[model samples]
Target: MNSQDETQIAVLRNLYAKQAHLIDTGQHEGWAQTFTADGEFHSPTYGEPAIGHDQLADISRRFSESAQQAGERHRHVIENIWVTECDGSSAQVRAYVMIVGTDIERKQARILRIVTNIDQLEKSADGWLIRHRKVEY
Candidate 1:
């Protein structure tokens, strides 16, 4: 791989790592900022309909509220990410994510879901942004 290729992969990895941290910490506001204004967030499905960034924000809000109400703690693990077509400014990516939730009251660990995402990323004047994201369960 060339230097340019290395740079692009590094950028994408950094951005994605930040997103994972934000989600794990329940920082919905910061997580929403990681995408472009018109970015879409979907499930891990290969062809699921997506809600826009604004809608995603709303969903995050509701999720946070519910988590607080239930006193739940969660850790989202993103693994086995493979990057293709790296071009310094954009690329296509695939990743597998597992969300584990723990209920303090019940003392039980549950595997909430498994997710896969195919994402298109672009780097603009501002920074690396997710141009299009398709998620499948």
Candidate 2:
């Protein structure tokens, strides 16, 4: 790969890593920002789907609030990033994800989620961000 290709790849990776860290840090707003204005989070665990920025923010807010109440620690690991397109302006990213939530009171650790996301992204002046993410179990 050339230098420019390598740079675009790095930028995409940063987007994934940033959201993962934000999730662990309980920064749901930051997480929502990683998505486009019309981004969607399609997780069956939540029952109702969140579509659009404000809805996504509210949904994530509730999730974050619940996590805070539970006082559990979380870690979201993203791996196997496969970039189908990386021209910089837009790209497709596929990644494996495993989220673990450990209950402090129970002192237990368990796998929370094992899944993958086929993410459609757009590159803006600010950076690369997810335009849409189709999540599959």
- TM-scores for all candidates? 0.82, 0.87
Lowest-sum lDDT 10-residue window in model 2: 59-68
Candidate 1 residue pairs that clash: 43-135, 44-135, 44-136, 44-137, 45-135, 45-136, 45-137, 46-136
Best by lDDT: 2
lDDT for each residue of candidate 1 in 16-91, tens digit (9 for 90 to 100):
8888788667788777777777878765431344455766566556556666676787766788778877776777
lDDT of each: 0.74, 0.81
**What's every prediction's RMSD, in angstroms?**
2.8, 1.9
Regions of model 1 farther than 4 Å from truth: 44-52, 105-108
Model 2 over residues 63-114: C-alpha lDDT tens digits?
A: 6676668777777789999888887689999999887878889989888789
Stretches of candidate 2 exceeding 4 Å from the true structure: 69-71
